[model samples]
Target chain A: MTQKTLRKGNEALAEGAIRAGARFFAGYPITPQNEVPEYMAAHMADNGGAFVQAESEVAAINMVYGAAATGTRSMTSSSSPGISLKQEGITYLASADLPCLIVNVMRGGPGLGSISGAQGDYFQATRGGGNGDYHIIVLAPNSVEELGNFPKLGFDLAEKYRMPCMILADGILGQMMESMAFNFDPVDPNKIGKFDWAVDIHKNGRKKSKVFSYKGDNLIADVTERAKRYGLIEKTEARYEARNCEGADVILVAYGLSSRACLEAVSKAEEKGLKVGLFRPITLWPFPSKALKEVSQKAKGILVVEQSLGQLVQDVKLAVGDSVPVGLNAYPAGGQPDGEQILTAAKSLLTGKKEGLFDLQTHAEGFTYECKRDLSLGVQGDRKEVK
Target chain B: MSTILAKKPSTLTDLPMHYCPGCGHGIVHRLLAETFEELNIADRVIGVAPVGCAVFADDYFTCDTVQGAHGRGPAIATGVKRSKPGAIVFSYQGDGDLASIGMAEIVHAAVRSENITVIFINNAIYGMTGGQMAPTTLVGQVATTAPKGRDPKMQGWPINMCEMLSQITGSKYLARVAVDTPQNVLKAKACIKKAFENQVNNVGFSMVEVISQCPTNWHASVEQALEFVRTKMIPQYPLGVFKDEGAK
Candidate 1:
């Protein structure tokens, strides 16, 4: 049996990157994810890696871009707003066909909502938040073990596809401590073969190499070629974990920390003589849609559980596409759903009660009270009172 | 056979540059190419090209080049150089790139004293974007964005990179030169060589700001552009070694 040691999720992920031969790391301080850069600063240099606490998230991502061009495994991590700052660099990295890891330790947002964990960044992560037609492979880790182990998997997929890979976890997973053992041997990049297109010392009489994203004339052709890879990835890489999904009355769809609640709900639903299934997507971008469609075939209805109000439900709807009734159990703005809460939502799905189950619309409708306008204030600059 | 007095640097490719006539980029590129040949570090040299006029510098120089988004050359160069200490990394930037959008990157790279060389081309206008005001655009100079001719109160003062960077404790060498006259061109090349030599010795951060000419953007003919560089631009950005820790 492998010995497990207690480690914070953020530290585990950082150590995972180091063990996976990520030789370059650049990051800035942001809540929940601050431990990531802290761990890198402490351990990266001793492990023969370069760690930079960049002046900003924008600079950090660009540094990753430069390191990636040299065929070094590079990474940067931040929360929502910081991740937003990195989007420009992320698009450039994808355009230049550079592989690197980007970790988004999600926090409440629309903008600086809170430092507490939230799943509000689902659309941003899966939809390629940057401006351009590109998709980065996104992984959702539910456990501290997966958080510690996902870097190797993320790096492999990124290098194989020659694009960026993101590990999307909320603040809860980042702060929580768990006993997890690394599943892979420590990597030594010195022994790895070099990438031919990498910008490095010209050895063996190789011609000068250029790594650039400015494809002036060949932009369309390059995008079309990249789309083919996206299609292939969609066909090839979609992983999920399913329980009692063969033929259940209701199926619960969730990911990351939210999935853990769904898993517990599934087990409890079994004890209650209700056949509820849980389908948790591990790979969020190549989002296990086909597998989901297969598992949800026999289910009468589907309930999407997530920390956000409706972000994950969008992908869930797209996957099932009205073949079955889809419902949402939402907790927006840094709210976490417990197993009991999820189980009640699952029961509501089975009973066909749309009251508290699909309450997002109801809540929106509840906010329809007329705004009390001050007559004295009038309409801003066009004040009614003659001064 | 006639004895050849001079030839093009080996590292400079035969490809014709797309720079406008009377532009200083051609001269500066040649100077860097010559430095690479002299130092015999062409194979190990990693050149970072920014999003300005010199974006196609990868094609001009026979080196491993990484061209990235605007104003990020220094950060990228730091990444490349730190990953492989044996590699000679140089981030080549224009006024708009280094001074404006990428100000923090350049300042922080200098602050950290990353062992790299910086080749800054200061022409006072955004070249690739076509005659816009740059961070180094002189007060009272007419730019497309500043049609009123760079009012000091409205627009901020032009940045002198060498003099500004000289104050940075981490910077080892900071020189500002020009390629307008034949003598100054030679002097610029020597300054450029010294910057690269500092990197070769792995001492600290070194930057050589070349006061370049942009005829098209300056709305001047070749002769007028060179004259503007010599008279108008040189006075505002005085040529000198602002700081040289090695000399001390």
Candidate 2:
């Protein structure tokens, strides 16, 4: 039976890796996610497993790449600045299609911005951080429970797709304690079969093999095939969670801790007689655009709430097209958006008013005072038409 | 017969070696392959080769082998050892790969007490990439990068690997040996065997730094390389067991 225990996101990640049959961990410590390496060191020490506190993040990532090449389950964890140092190895792993798990407990940063919880790395995690026409399956967990469960899923997806999978979380989710289930099914490595290319000992009559990332065939054909594979993955694996989306007039799109806050706001807005909902994406790379489009059909607007400057909002806008208005509830670096504030914005949109919502692209679009007055007059004339 | 010239044992198949004639790497490779044969651990041994002179080591050693990027052998070996706890994993690294680029990898792997063996070959220069001076090159040693002889004021001192590695508690066995003479080759073989045995017994990190000769890079004859090893390398990196608690 699955049992629950008090655990933080980092501990859950450690347990999940163990459950997924990860036998090796090589990482250097970084704040907010140091517990992962520490736990692996202690646990692997007693089990005759391997754990190495590499001298730097660069060394740790290359180590993971090497281990993964041998068809073994291995992992590493770090925060923003440290993760940046690992881009070189990550690109190589992606090019090789090596299977491994990487956990990033994000803190504020363009460059050492802050140690506090921040969702500032959404683009880097989703897009190309390293140099390559490749993508990693990025899983963003919204709760302590998901933090525990996603590592196993990440490992399975890594092996299944032959690609790296990331558990993109923030410092708060990593450090906060909550009760969670710890039991997991045992992994049978043969289920995935021994990688024929793995550099393992061969007995008599076995032919030598190679495991490299070089794509040396017809250049265009090789890149074209890789692109086709990525397209297939995009079609099949993109996943997200939605709540109260049925017949809702307004949707809130967010990820990680911000999604949790958006869920609370959506519930409060519902109590105050506004049709509100939430869309929390699980896989950020194979983004849940289809699901967002389906939700947008019934919604009048989408409020993209996030801890960063609403990076995902652009994605939502792209998904929904111009069929519905896409709003923003941005909470810049230091402050967090309150549920009351979100509720008020929902009320304004429900009543056909659009005066005080945050418009991240307003000045960039060159909206002057004259434009606002003209828009307000138009809205008044539309009200007269309704009367 | 010494382990150095023991007829290429079953552990190391006679698959025409790809190394150049008079290359000391061949001697070091034979010593390790024969050690695996002597210990009867060939079936369960895994070798990690770096991107240097020993890149094709798998063609020589009969055991399972994987290649790592430059300076990443130790980390890869640590991962292999961790995942396959019942198997023996060792990284065969050269002076440039181990002492220079991979310095951080080897150091931290030893510090963590990873239960893997490392056979570090210090030839005082980078042989594969055309004889650049290595971090282990002695103060007065000359190489392509150190044309004026390694200047102590400009370049750093020759790294004493055995002495430095002995500081790590994670290492159960650490030693520096050489292959200049018949007697010294024997001692070096014994040290390598012990390091491998330590891993078999799960005794933690083990390493043997072999002070080797590089005739091509050092601009000397095969006999002269041996002579240089004895007259120059040995005095700097003495042939002895620096640290060993393996039998305990």
Task: Write model 2 residue lDDT over A1-387, tens digit each, in one string.
Answer: 268888978888787777677877888888889889988987965554568778889888887877787788878999999999888778767876788999999988878888878787888888858876888889999888889888888998888888899999988999998888845675544465788766665566365544444444644675677688789888999899999988888888888888887778887876778888988888988888988898779788887877776578778877888888887666655345567666666655666555435654444565422222121111111111111
Clashing pairs in 2: A201-B64
**True lDDT of residue A82, candidate 2:** 90
Docking class of 2: acceptable
* Cand. 2 Cα-lDDT: 0.79
> Could you list the CA RMSD of all candidates, in the order they appear?
5.5, 6.6
Candidate that would win on TM-score:
1
- Chain A TM-scores, per candidate, are 0.92, 0.89
lDDT of 1 at A61: 97
Q: Write the per-residue lDDT of candidate 1 for residues A319-369, one digit (tens) a residue.
A: 988798887777777777777777676777678554336443333344322
What is candidate 2's lDDT per residue for B1-248, written digit by digit as tens?
Answer: 65565366776767888766677777788888778888988777888877787887866877777665778788777777767777788999998898888888888888888889999988898888888889989888888889999999999898888789888887779888888777878888889899988888888999999888888888899899989888888888887777777867
Per-model lDDT: 0.89, 0.79
Q: What is the TM-score of chain B in candidate 1?
A: 0.98
The TM-score obtained for chain B by all candidates, in the order given, is: 0.98, 0.95
